[model samples]
Target chain A: MKRNNDNIKYDSKVISIRNLKKAFDDFEVLKGVDVDLYQGENLVVLGRSGTGKSVLIKIISGLLRADEGTVNVLGQEITNITIKNLDRLRLKIGFSFQNSALYDSMTVKENLEFPLRRHVKNLSTKEVNQNIEMILEAVGLSQAINQMPSELSGGQRKRIGIARTLILKPEIMLYDEPTAGLDPITCIDINNLINEVQERFHTSAIIITHDLTCAKATGDRVVMLLDGRFKYEGTFEDVFKQTDDEMVQRFHDYNFIE
Target chain B: MKEKTKSKFFLSKKIDKVFIKLNDIWLFVFRFFKEVFVPPYEFKEIVNQCFELGVRSLPLISLTGFIIGIVFTNQSRPSLESFGATSWLPALMSIAIIRAMAPLVTALIASGRVASKIGAEIGSMKVSEQIEALEVSAINPFKYLVVSRIVATTLMVPALTLYTALVALLGAFVNVYQFEGTSFTSFFVQVFEAITFLDVFSSVIKSFIFGFTIGVVGCYKGYTSSRGTEGVGKAANTSVVTAMFLIFIEELLSLQIINALRIVD
Candidate 1:
């Protein structure tokens, strides 16, 4: 566990998840998980499937409650607050899901405009439309604005999801398996886009992934989750430089297979 | 010894099941308020949901209500004639329609049609991680799905009940005029005179509770529903059954409560 008491200077640390514990009928998924996210940095949480990586991020976003824990984001304690306050806190953090999670009933443009129209206050219709177009262009999907999510390819849908997250201009972004189902080239493109977004907006990000390639490329710092606890925590280079750990060695060896 | 162990195991398992169900109920009640008053209502998806859930359900509800009115009147007429109370048919049928039949029948239709639709839609959304996606997007799922549905049901079910009552009277009138020289104006006078505010109030209040129950049960089942298409089917089935049962119980209870309160007053 890393202590942040001495290093606390910035008022906006993006997110702090402390002692999160979640369970489903005695399954006990997350066990006392603690993490801190800072501004303008990409932190990738790498783990096997069903290892509580996504659960950690979900707790921070207030999607799922920590059975017993405190989640502080942008200086607000989310666990004890009312839902209205939670929503207010969430406006500062945007999220892109694994499957794109685009509204099947809506066109890509409508999906992009959903949060904007809901949360953004006092924006005229013209302004909302303009913002939509701006975000669509940023994600390089202005041409596919009218197309339904079903009509788009996997990569295009992913890009549209990214566009929807970015439209709110959030200070913090959470990505759950952003590059999971895409091709290698598309994965690289998404990683580059994430980096570009970080530089442009100075936004902090928490990326949940099992793909080491994605973790190394997108992560400024990386943490490895195993058996409901973080087994490794450091920069990408620090994690890759080791050979003693069996899982890391295996992951490294598998990357060389093709 | 084996018998004792077996009984103990069964008892503990039953207790565990009760505990879990109670937990789910409590969580949903907590989430109900949490989502309703929460900011950022997810207006776009909710509009889409209302169109899909409320507007699309109108056709089925109207069709069912119309059929129920026609058939129920046609069936009850011959039986009334046997008892020499054929002329009492107008008042009798009106009392029936205005008190219990209209609301209960409409609710059954809603349970089968609207409740199942809401349950299946939300269930599949849950299975596919769409609900989780909404939460991650900072959108409250309960407000987005449940409140919009409750509001829609609140508005539409009363309108549907009124439609059922009207159609039922029309069907009874048609049945009545087909045989004897029973005047339409006379039938209207008898039926309208027989209806007190108590009858009308009870039926309307019952339908409102039925609608609210359907919305709450359907949303609860679907939201807590597990993964896969099987889970979706289970949610839809359970929601319809739960809503139907609750509506019946509410009708019985509300009638008794109304009568008791009237007596006291």
Candidate 2:
């Protein structure tokens, strides 16, 4: 492990996975992978497209099940958990999808209210409105409360999506490609938002991305997934330090854009 | 012999895939039934979907139903004249519209219009990861998305059919009054006297079946749709096609059952 950062928080593992195996029929996406997410730390999982970065987070969130290993998330084994139990566990996890995944039919306020309405069922209308208002302000989109998803730009949509996730005040956040197809400045803003979310929400996170800049800006520790396993684990520089490996050098070539 | 075996194997594989998909759809429906009766009934969503699938569809239903009445009345008017029974026009047109045409036309339109809408809406939601977002939020996406629409369709289709029946009858009456100058009261009296209770009941029942088919097939296609634009397109297309096909099948089966019931009654 590379401890390049001066301040590295090492709390007890919020997510613990060991020998995780997942396959789609004949194609094995996650072949015996192991990792851990510490409390209040940002762990970046770097991989090219189809390297199962999304699969890993999906397993952690109990959205997808592992075929042949243990995925213990929030102190519960997710693979064999009941639906009701999994749902209870999911309340503690907030997943920010790559596409933002805001309900196109709903306005920003409705999108944010959906989770709170479900989980925090006892909140009065006034309280619900307050929560939505607070979340929108927190994401710096207070003016976008009445806006439909179609009216918003990609970055705005992403912010609303994050706000929606954060409304529940989850203990763990899972960001899947927070800045995949954005301009560099927007990417930086999203990266800053990730850091802000961790700091402000007091939540651990696993950010799955292929962007090296994002890895540097947000990741307290970086893990490079190659061919369904973590090939590099450490700081951003440490991941690319061993240039002798042809695959790592190639991945570095792709992500380290000028 | 090897080539023959390989071909047979491929066919078997295809059949197995279809069966697997069918099984999954059945399980999805069963799960929907299980979840629908559980607590926190999602009353608001159900009402929202009812408004979407029911009340919002009235104008289209009225237009199609009116046209069906006009076309059927105009085409069949001369035939009754050929039989020297022009007085039977109101009775025959009313019976046809109330029993067969209204249910079929309304269902076909519902299958074409509403099923595709549902499939595309849910398909887009599925592909865009909106459904999973709901799941992550601990919300029952099936209950919110599927059950609400199904219940709305099941209730509203029959209601729409009745509305169609009225509009269609008004259309037929216009044709009758123009050609023969029959009074409105007499025409309605003849219409009511000609049709039995079983006919109206059967038409409502068939409409209900059509509604259920539209809801189930549309939701299944959408919820199980693959990712991407192509998948969404396929889901919408298959939703309309499958619902229409099932509607026709149900129409035949229902007519047969109703005919048997007519004999008993």
Candidate 3:
């Protein structure tokens, strides 16, 4: 399942976080974390639940601001930027939430169109329709376009959620547990979709998951987060096999069982 | 001394919670005002919410208004009869409905329906990360969700209040005709003569405040909801209760302001 990233281009750093520190009161979720996400590469941030995987991505996307350190996302330090300015920067970053986070009030088509209509306000009706149609087809959920989020299954919802983000045509995608709560087949399908998204769109992504299979399938380069810092960094096999630490092995085995 | 200190400590904790809540509300309202006038106004969303909060609540408002009017008319008949003021029935009822009962009834009903609906809807959206989804999309969730609902309620309450005044008048007329054989035109003529422009204006202004109160309380509760799924239920419950509580406070304040303004006039 390890897709070769030998040919994947890394023209520039899409995201570079140096000494990123975020905490909730005394709980230091991400402490002095440093990471880089390069262009046209699917960088998987692997960690167990509550291991700051989601928090890292949230900071990258500016959903949650880092308490300390510089998070340079697409060349802007998010911590120093105002919300109005950050929103402009956020249009370039697509964040798919752990629960898919589709607007329950809206149908799938509306959910997809939500981002498009907001960011690209001047698109013609024809162009809007084309974009919706194209993105829905890309996610392979064109049939479920009119259905509400509640009507779709977990996998379908995740697909539509990715489609919604894709409609914005972001330069970077941040998938937060895109395969968190799905069956093995659905997980594989999501993993394949993540890879296809990179291949087709030629976009950089930071896929956060504890699922080893997902990381191997989607990630071009993998990093394992332990104690709020990456303990292993390399290809999935290199990181997993090259590590001699018992904690890293235990985490890997634990992740495999889960 | 120890018991007194403990009591004081608990009291201080309660006060601290209130102060923190007040600060949050101040910021929330501040943000609401800031976003409301900003560009990219969600007019379509505001209109849709108005349709949902306004047009959808009309039948219920009308029914409640009518029943209130009939019951009030029946209850006041004996008192007026004893005083030889039975002829003043239409005028008295119209005055009371326009001034007090109509807006109060409409807002109370809406607090149950609209406030709880807004609370639960937004609370669920918050828990489900739909609000964050909008934020990540560069669409302001506060502007789209909170402002739109607030604008809808602010507008719809007054409109519903106006409609209730008319419906309640009709109900009062039906009762008057059934009991005392008054004609439709006669009852309306008496009602209209008794209701001044100030009465109409005050009712409208009061309803607007009631609507705003309901909207703000509902949005505040729902937006700041915690405890996940359980939070959503608590949000709906608290929204209804808080909105109703604030509505009464607003009603009293509006009444006092109106009385002061009348004296000035």
Two-chain DockQ for each candidate model: 0.28, 0.51, 0.48
In model 2, where do residues sit more than 4 Å from their true spots? A1-11, B1-11
User: What do the candidate models score in CA lDDT, each in turn?
Assistant: 0.79, 0.88, 0.89
Q: Which candidate number would show the highest DockQ if scored against the true structure?
A: 2
Q: Which residue runs does candidate 1 get wrong by more than 4 Å?
A: A1-38, A65-72, A75-85, A227-238, A256-258, B1-11, B19-23, B26-55, B82-85, B181-183, B255-265
Best of the two (1, 3) by TM-score: 3
Identify the runs in model 3 with alpha carbons over 4 angstroms from their true place: A1-7, A255-258, B1-11
Query: What's the TM-score of candidate 2 when only chain A is evaluated?
Result: 0.95
- How big is the positional error of residue B186 in model 1, measured in Å on the Cα after superposition? 3.1
lDDT of 2 at A216: 88
Range of the 10 consecutive residues with the lowest summed lDDT in candidate 2 chain A? A1-10
- Per-residue lDDT tens digits for candidate 1, residues A1-258, read 121123223455778877878876657777888888877778899888888888788778877777887788888897787877887777788788888878777798888777887778799999999998988877777899899999999889888888888888888889999898889889888887787777666688999998877877778788888777776788877876753688876766676323
Q: Which prediction has the highest lDDT against the true structure? A: 3
Q: Per-residue alpha-carbon lDDT of model 3 for B1-265, expressed as tens digits?
A: 0111232454579787898789999999898889899988899999999999999998898899899989999999999999999999999999999999999999999999999999999999999998888888888889999999999999999999999989998899999999999999999999999988889999999999899989998899999998899999999999999999988988899899989988988
Per-residue lDDT over A1-258 for candidate 3, one digit per residue giving the tens place of the 0 to 100 score: 345566566678888889988887667888789888888889999887888998898888777878788889888888889988899988888899899999888899888777777778789988998999999888888899789999999999999989988888889999999998899999989988898888777789999988888888888889989898887899888998997889778867876543
**Candidate 2, position B98, lDDT:** 89
Clashing pairs in 3: none
